[model samples]
Target chain A: MIQFTNISKSFDEVKAVRNVSLSIDEGQLFGFIGPDGAGKTTLFRMLNSLLIADEGSIELFGLDPHKDYKKVRQIIGYMPGKFSLYYDLSIEENLNFFATVFGTTIEENYHLIEDIYKQIEPFKKRHAGKLSGGMKQKLALCCALIHKPKLLLLDEPTTGVDAVSRREFWDMLKSLKSKGITIVVSTPYMDEAGMCDSVALMQNGQIHAVESPKAIVDNFQKELLAVKCNDMYKALLTLRNYENCYNVYPFGEYLHYIDKRDSKPIEDINDCLLKHDLQEIEINPVKPDIEDCFIELTRKLSV
Target chain B: MENEQVIIVRDLVKKFGDFTANAGLNFHVDKGEIFGFLGANGAGKTTAMRILCGLSSPTSGLVEVAGYNVKTHAEEVKKRIGYMSQKFSLFEDLTIWENMRFFSTVYGMNKTAFKERGEMLLRKLELFEKRNRLVSTLSLGWKQKLAFTVAILHEPSIVFLDEPTGGVDPITRRQFWEMIYEAADNGITVFVTTHYMDEAEYCNRVTIMVDGRIDALDTPAKLKEKYQVNSMNDVFLALAR
Candidate 1:
């Protein structure tokens, strides 16, 4: 289990994280959702003890990260946002090094990373840098797990990785979680937020909302509508100009708009667009997803 | 000539030493099209893009970009194309205005024309107030938008974007695609590489690469239909996996 109370961190003039608090239950899969400058990385570093918080305290497994970092480092598996694995070293060599550094051998904790390691085992001799993005990611996870750590902290593990590979990686994480490893992952992709048992949406270094994906979606107050027309760009602009429109943005091929009114107002919306002579217009009431909730939540924070 | 082909690659192969980075690739990008180049890392997307951009030579096969043969007219091809890599191709130390001026001149834009267009662009993006701020000071989304605008500053016939939306938030990514659509509307071809499958849906057409070879190429809808899948992500998995 991990807990942060009123934690804050700053670098020069930028307050990366400000007055944030959250508690993660043991063996639970948690996600930190935010954009690039939203301070997800800073919060992860504080938990990893790589960077100390400017204020407040952090407790991991009833131990202070700053005071007991030595034990913290041993039990926590960290895959930084950037690939910190040695590019020149072979995959097998990197695994050996990590295992040995943790005072263990690959054979001792082989079962911990068996599923992931097998994917990259065929290319065990390939240099880490030469491997594909997916292979390197698996290898990194394997290295982080070689010592059989109790917790895993992966920062943006799916960024820059193709969608298929990203799905595969998440599947691997799910399996890892089934083994009772507490996983803390951070990502900017809102779709991935649903994969977590619970998520803490952070923005501008503050935690806007923390809840299950379903809870967040259920909490979305606005009535949602999905509209598709001949010209998507023009439709987006026109929809944004509607009087009752609270938010309108592109979602795949359709422009998902949230109305300020409680009702869907399909007829009024149609009449508004009819005046513009848009073709192939289709408007339907739709359920909001985690992304819609996230956008709505963050918009409120900004305003 | 309604949808003229601006990029053509036939049996294109690129090898380094004994490694074949690109293997017998064939694809064509239409003018004014939003073309998606997608693949797993190490699938040879970068190698093929470099060859098309005239930054590297192909080992064999015919390739043309912007009406010029990449091999024989590398210089000519370079002039008519713009490229922005994932890292955001901008000088971090330079102010926004300075970076804009520098890239326009590099593209051989007239000094007077750049002055007028540069101001207009900054104002349109609402970055005119921060024109003197260092590029590094801007947020990730702002930097990406600026890099994109600079890439097309000269109105190149084709602009190459190598994973332009990596690590950006959803709202910013959507806004960035609006910019891409705007460019395509102006008759400038956009050849972009991205990992987000949702982005592929916005493209006019997409090509998926696997192990140094193109596995699939068509409009997002067509590919999804051909693969009997519901999304581009599923289509890519069907081909690449």
Candidate 2:
């Protein structure tokens, strides 16, 4: 369990975090979803007691993070966004080092990371720096879990990883969650937000919304339209210039279109594209996803 | 002219001692096409891209980029192609204008041409006022957009982008794709790699690599139908599994 009351932090002129107040229940898989410079890292550092907040208070399991820094660190496993491990050391050595630092041995918590560590056990003798990106990630997770911490703080674990590896990493997290560990993760990918039990969408050092992924998507008020045509690029330009067009962006194979009218102007949109000499235009109303909701939230803030 | 092949790779094999990074890759990228290069980690996407960009040599087979054999005319290939990656592209310590000037000079652009084109581009991206600000001062979205603009500043025939929008926001990511679209429309071929499945759908053609081999190659629609999936994410999951 964790709680933050009116948390505000600033570095010189830029406010890294702006009065963010959030709480995570025990055994909940909470996610901090935002892009780089969105204060996810800052919030994590503050919670880990590595960075002091400019104002407000933070409590981890009813214990103040700053006042009880040592105790807080013992119960929390913090994985920074940047890979922070002994690259020169072998995988086994790195895992042992982390376990020793936490006043524990690998045998004491072998069950905690056995599912993940076993995959890289064959290459335990290899240097951490020599391992590939995915291998390094697995090793790092094993290190983070070596102490059997009750809370796991993963900062953008899948930021630079590929799709397949990202999926694999999420599966591992789900398994860890099943073990009754409170997992707090951050990522820039909106698609990953769905995997979390609840997510806080942060942007410009502020939390826009904190709710279940399904609730966020259901809150999308606009009637979104997916438009596909022979020439998507030309169609995007044409749709952007439409009089009632509020926002038009390329979403995979089709352009997601939204208008400023209450009634769905599908015919008018089709006519506009047709007048622009676009062909094979197919416009259909589609459900909004988490990314759409996040974009709408950010746009609302700017407006 | 539109259908002209700008990049041709045939039986391209790259070996690292006992390991074969690229077993045998055979593909051609047409002019003005957005080609997506995708693969799992250690799947040889980087190996093939390095060979195509002339950053590394192939063990065997013929690889040509920008109408020149990369094995022999690596310099010519480098001259006609621009490369940018998510990790490293621009100088963070340097100001926006200085980074642009440095890259332009490396690409052998004249002072007058660099100044005119750089100013125009900065103005278009609405960063002319902040040209003197260091790249580190700007946000990640701004840095990526600037890096992309500078990548195409030299007017390369083909641009190589490796996970260029890795951590960019949703809105800025779409804006970056719009830039790619504009560049391709100007006859500049785009060779990009990304983890976002929705992004793979935007490519004119995509080649998915698996274990140093080309697993599948086709347009998004065709690949979806072939794999009996609704999205590129499913297609990738099916193959990479």
- DockQ scores of the candidates: 0.58, 0.76
Q: Write the per-residue lDDT of candidate 2 for residues A1-303, one digit (tens) a residue.
A: 799889999999999999999999999899999988899999999999999999999999988889999999999998887778899999999999999999999999999899899999999999999998888899999999999999999999887777888899999999999999999999988889989999999998999999999999999999999999988888988888788999999887789999999997999999999999989989999999888998899999999
For candidate 1, write residues A1-303 as lDDT tens digits: 799999999999999999999999999999999889999999999998899999999999998989999999999999998878999999999999999999999999899899888889999999999998888899999988988889899999998787888999999999999999999999988878989999998878999899988898999878888898777777777888989888898777678988788865888888888888888899998888877887888788779
Model 2 residue B17 CA deviation in Å: 3.2
Could you tell me the fnat of model 1? 0.59
What does the lDDT come to for candidate 1? 0.89
Evaluate all candidate structures by whole-model CA lDDT and list the values in order.
Answer: 0.89, 0.92
After superposing candidate 2 on the true structure, give the runs of residues whose Cα lies further than 4 Å from its correct spot.
none
Positional deviation of residue B29's Cα in model 1 after best superposition, in angstroms: 3.3
TM-score, model 2 to reference: 0.97
- DockQ, model 2, C-alpha based: 0.76
